[model samples]
Target: MEHRVVLVTGGSSGIGKSIGIYLKSKGFKVYGTTRRLDSHPNFTDFELLELDVRNPESIGFAIARLMEREGRLDVLINNAGIGITGPIEETPHSEILKAFDTNFNGPIHMSKAVLPHMRRQEKGLIINITSIAGYMGLPYRGFYSASKGALELVTEALRMEVKGFGVNITNLAPGDFATNIASGRYHAPILSDSPYKEPYGNTLKMMNEHVDSGKDPMLVAQMVFKIINTKNPKVHYKVGEFMQKFSLFLKKILPDKVYEKLLMNHYKL
Candidate 1:
């Protein structure tokens, strides 16, 4: 009858927020982290921790505080991330670094911080929020896709590495969910006036439109809950509509050139 202790990063809004609330409703002792404390009002009935996933010190401090208070860490959802839209060539070095820091390195830092506690307990779950873009690359979202791809790889390696310790790892690769993740997309400074602007202009617009009309965020939260509770959890959970199915199909059935053509046509590239 013990309640599970769950920590969700970037839980102030979007999929993370929904997931946090859903977990809370399931009787979990949920702790949500956000970089902006002002936005904490959106998340009620859950402990709020101020954390910037990009900062190792912030991650370490938050984990330490949680461990000190609760004495055990049952689940860690690395959900903090940022998206960048536009051509890869037009993305500034600094912006790319920022994307990687948040999307890729952040989870790595959090996982490292939580490992000791989970290792000690010999039982825990780590759910990493990846994207469908991780499986199938999208136009004007190269950097974002790359970051998620890195996360997918990390999730795989960690899954195997932690199995010996009885710690489970799951990568939640949700397709276009109705999250504000699209609105949260950052444009690189170089992309604003770069030569590649004209070429990728329409593609960017289409990308935004697709994201703006994405699936419900709650679907992702439900899937996450399922993954956590399942006896034999999948390493990767793909959700959403055409994107999820298409991504998996391309990986398994389509020829490289055929998939490339379809992707180009789909994105108007």
Candidate 2:
């Protein structure tokens, strides 16, 4: 088989970095994008591209550069996103916009930019990195969940829309992965004083604790490779241990009230 050319956004660190490295190890020509190009840790074989997914021009420029050099893009991974922790009411509008721009719109723009090329070739794969929160709502993570949930829907729609063109779209919903995702390094809006301050505060604390104990990002990267290599991959792939099972089961058998109660108890709400 011919080696595939893969592009991963937010590849400077965490799951994106792991995927880029893993794909390179498997002999794929991998190009990784990062907002902070200078800060990206040096990876021997992968190409690093500076891309701000929120900017349409940036995404276009990056894709143009890649296509100019590589001639074709076989796989595009939309993994650049930010995590915000706050109650829906307390979260500022600007923060919500930022989340949507990065999480949802970014992927949409990237997909659009690459589609012409993919369609012309009549073969390609698009992998979207969403979250378990996309499948199950979490306390104090409403904004984040909403953003990811939107991406989930987009992925599903795109999958069917591109089927005739031989393009596959897969959504990867990972539970908690060990990464700097909760470190507030990406971007966030200022918190405001509100009536539900205590619950919001407590929720943020709980989120930090849970994220600190999350699974290795390498596991997620491995799953990405598996999905891409498969001749016919599933529309959705869930990673992680407990969260994965819980999300799947809750969506299938649990009642809304029961699921809500379990979530509240888990988060000490």
Candidate 3:
């Protein structure tokens, strides 16, 4: 029996890399994507391919190359995304657009590129790595949350659309993970004289500190493997510490204003 082929976007480092390696250990033939082949990190087990999710041509090319060789893409992990931090009012329009492009639109593009093949196979899984922020807005990270929320909605709609083809899809929302995402994160320029600078700086500081102390990326990888082993996956899976994952549950049950106050209070706003 042949091992199923898995493709993970943004696999050079962080969660993507962890998922790729973990899946490989489980006997899956995994291929991870980096924006540039030359920039791929020192990954030993799985193969690497060049893929820039923001570019449709690149997405198409990457999937095409994989299809040409594997003849089947059993699983696609849309794990590539970027983080931008700053006040919504102060963030550059271009920066916000870029966030949506890479986070939301990129997954859509990749999904579209791979769907036809998955449809042909009549069995496939697409796991999208979203964030807990998608459930509610976060200060200084509004656009990131917005982008993730948008993609979650897309996943919800797409799942209904693709069920007939035997394609399984789910949005995996991670609370926080100790990863290189902060180092590669895009920070908007905070002018010294800007009114929002003080709060923005404080919020950004808190956010990074939270992530620094967050759950291990391997935990998420393990969750991904579990999801794969299941015959029928859920529409959403939240992986992280109790509070982080439970907050979403709270939001669902609490009144809007109460939840808003709780969220604001937690962030020290």
lDDT of each: 0.86, 0.85, 0.92
TM-score of 3: 0.97
TM-score of each: 0.94, 0.93, 0.97
> In model 2, which range of ten residues has the least summed lDDT?
184-193
The runs of at least 3 residues in candidate 1 whose Cα sits more than 4 Å from the true structure, single-residue gaps closed, are 189-195
Candidate 3 per-residue C-alpha lDDT over 115-185 given as tens digits, one digit per residue, 9 for 90 to 100 = 99999999999999999989899888999999999999999999999999999999999989999889888
lDDT of 1 by residue, 13-98 (tens): 88898899899999999999999788656556578899999999988888889989999999999999998976677667888999
Tens digits of per-residue lDDT, candidate 2, 1-269, equal 77899999998778898899998898899999987777756655478998999888998998999999989999999998898876677567887888898999999999999999999999999999998888867777887888899899878888999899999999998888778888753323335656667767777777777678888888988999999888877888889877565666876788889878888887777
Query: Cα lDDT for residue 216, model 3?
Result: 86
Residue 17 lDDT (model 2): 87
Q: Arrange candidates, best TM-score first.
A: 3, 1, 2
What C-alpha lDDT, on a 0 to 100 scale, does residue 143 get in candidate 1? 89
Best by lDDT: 3
Q: In model 3, where do residues sit more than 4 Å from their true spots?
A: none
Ranking by lDDT: 3, 1, 2
